[model samples]
Target: MKKLIIVFGIIALTLVSCKNGDENNADKKTAVRKKVPVRKEPKNVSYTLESAKEWLKKNKSKQNLKISLAVNRTDKENFAKMDSVIIPTDLSGDIVFYLPFPLQVDFLQNVDKIILFSYPTQAFAVYENGILIRTGPTNMGKAKDPTPTGLFFTNWKAEETTSTFNDEWELKWNFNIENKKGVGFHQYELPGYPASHSCMRLQEKDAKFLYEWADQWVLADDENVKFKGTPVVVFGSYDFDAPKPWLQLIKNPKALAIPESEIKEIIMPYLSTILKEQEKRKKT
Candidate 1:
């Protein structure tokens, strides 16, 4: 009996030692540590002030872009369109048009004096010897500040401009006017009829040759013709004699001679003031 009790006591002692070790292991598991994550750094972009300025300068430029158009001012709806009729200088010498209030084509009839139509309306007129040659729709400034309605003379022209005006400045044939800094005629790209600040606008090609036309007569170096205080009559009404002036024949493919009754009349060798200048040049 003694031996059996001793054995039971040993076994109980062994069980207690195992239970203590198990509790110690449970505590260690509950106190386990955690790992931390690593972070990455960001990089910065750099540029020079001069380089930035150069980029902006290239992007924001206030330049006057050039454009060409074909227009007919007689029809308010057809002011600046290129549909059917185009009077090219090479074809008939009337392809280009100078839009002074309401003109659509820049024409070179090779005539003596040129006539502008559509004084203040979209539709203007062009005639040669009492015959209606062409018409189109155009836009002019407000009537309060309208383009004059009269027989005006071609006086000036410019192919390119360096001005900052909100207009197509580099123009062809800036015609004679009472005002120069404020008024004249040239080629313009109008958004619609009556789309000018104060000058006459026309198509680029028309304006190009028109400038040459006016320069032939008025520019001092080539000043061969003169019409001081030239009559710019905008009757707005078409008359046989008034509409078909003799000067318009310069465009005739067959070129009918200028009869005395029409132009270069009676004064035999009747030199205009410009004639004296020509004679002096010949003697030189």
Candidate 2:
């Protein structure tokens, strides 16, 4: 009888151990089945005026765009300057027209914004994700004082500032690109050719628009910026021997239209560097 009792006790102990083991295994399985939360990034909602035009053409709607205020008189005049006239309405309820050539740029995915000043074309373009958002005629540095080509960044900006070369010359919406050189983009006279003293001369409206739209570098000290500003690529060269290219626009406006392939070629060289800088900025 004692032997029987012993056997029954052992069986009971074995059963309890197996039950605890099963419970532990079930707990681990429940832990493994738990779902992990995922983080999502914000969607890119910004659209270019060109995209909006095509959308309206196909899916016609009474969707009135919330146009902002006119950048300046020159910006207003630029509407009459280009090929297609798709006017934008401003914040003050003013409708301003601008003509921009269709540019299908698809490669600048790493960039948020880029300013391209082409000396050969005598024009400046503002791009977002490779899409041409805005472009306008520019009077870059003359043959005597040609604007330096290569990659640059927006330094500091001033709403109203005097020219470092001549205090008598008042510049509006001045955004400096080079620190040592007193070269920048600002509202100045455009004589239909390369005229500025190494500056990118733009219309008053373009200057104001860029001033408000562009991101400026934080001044680290008197001479340097804490972080880099927006990228500006000044490429190509003007043939001082020949007449200004835009003069042909009188005969055919499309004459001045830059080929998409050419623009792509200009940006391709600096893209890798720009992307690297952008990544570094994001970390900081």
Candidate 3:
């Protein structure tokens, strides 16, 4: 009887030891499963004075570097003060990346050509078949003489024309949108802010490019337009009291990221009218 009782005790001890070992193994497996690598999110790079200098040095040899720098600076005067200028990190990239305009707009796919002048951003973008083709800086109306905002068609163009506001001021590559208001876009001085006499100002290169690109209205009579030319949408209000909008880019890289939805919204109101005119042009 004593031997049988001893054997039972030993068996019970072995079973408990095996159970403890199994529990330890399970704990080890749990720890192994927890040692996984995690993915990290990308951080946005901020612009700095040093980076701007480096960028300038790198692109100094570029042909359009001066114009690119001027546009980034928001004016020729600001560009002159390059030491203090804060520019986008991707300054060396395509101009589209820095400008506040979508690369592609779905709604504009059917439209042949359109031009947009953003008052607040002080920029102009040209879209051909919903794809952004070109963009550049613009110095628009002064606070006292603000550029009129609305839909207008290109009326007439001249390689060089005198400003109606001031005959002495010779405007180059001029394209008139509003004959009554004498409002047009042409090559003029960009003081780095809105200093125009209620007219849109562009760099000489941009002015010449647009001169050749935009079409003039087909006039049936002296005052009557038979077929309208390219559509021009001038929208938004500038805050003269506020500092330059591009300055905010120093803090946020996406400060000027104009949302695709916003572009769609802006165009929706005039989409029908633009399409009707486009169809009329096609027929002619």
Candidate 4:
């Protein structure tokens, strides 16, 4: 009977030891979990036009000024002359963050180069290997002369070219996509709206950036294009009747947000065509 009691006591001690070990392990796991830091989302703050200017004044820097001007769809010269400007309060000090385009596009991973112009947001984004390299504001065609939405390749380019519509108006960093229609993107005035005459208007710096980055079509003859240049997708439509989309940011920070899925949807129809062109370019 004494032997049986000793065995029972030993078993009880073993079970208690096992229980203590489990409790200690659970405590260790809880402590590890506590040590792990949680990520916090950025606060989206709204600002009035006056408050925006004040904020710009407080956070004065060349980059900040440039970003502010881009957000307002104007250049430094134009922004300086303006009485008030619309500013995104949640500007993370990066122009890329200020714009609505996604940072990475998985669908565009195979694509070497492509430019996207969003008419609704009045912004342009450049993607290389599915990553957003550059983005800025643009003033597309007016309501009466809406910029045609479709896929086009970069064609002829000139440092300084005379506008076909107006002899007096000189277009700088001019890149013509549609020779017949006289449609192209160039350095021009951005009145914070769609004021261009059926062409995409950009800031001087943005125009120059694209001029150097984008490739021009290789010509077989004067009229025929043997090899196409970089692909440009111009999509969506602006609401001329409604207030400017950027202004809506004052109420809703995500008012102009363009989802990655929507961007994928926009590029889906042209994926085959884009791939075919890419393959042909590789061979050439």
lDDT digits (tens) for residues 1-284 of candidate 1: 00001111122111000000111122222221222223221132111122222333343321101101222232212322323322212221222222222121112111222334343233334433222244333344443455555334443333444234423244343443433223555555544445554455554444444455433223323323333322222334222224221113234322212222322221112223322333333353
Candidate maximizing TM-score: 4
In candidate 3, stretches whose alpha carbon ends up further than 4 angstroms from where it belongs are: 1-46, 49-59, 63-70, 73-78, 81-83
TM-score of candidate 3 relative to the true fold: 0.77
The model with the greater lDDT, 2 or 3, is 3
Which stretches of model 4 miss by more than 4 angstroms?
1-46, 51-60, 90-92
TM-score of 1: 0.37
Residue pairs that clash (backbone atoms under 3 angstroms), model 2: 67-89, 67-90, 68-90, 68-91, 69-91, 71-205, 72-205, 79-97, 79-98
Better-scoring candidate (TM-score), 1 or 2: 2
> What TM-score would each prediction reach against the true structure?
0.37, 0.62, 0.77, 0.80
**Looking at model 3, which ten-residue stretch has the lowest summed lDDT?**
13-22
Q: By lDDT, is 3 or 4 better? A: 4
Report every candidate's CA lDDT. 0.31, 0.57, 0.67, 0.72
Instruction: Identify the candidate with maximal lDDT.
Output: 4
Evaluation by TM-score, superior candidate among 3 and 4: 4
What RMSD, rounded to one decimal, does every model reach? Answer: 45.1, 25.9, 30.3, 25.3
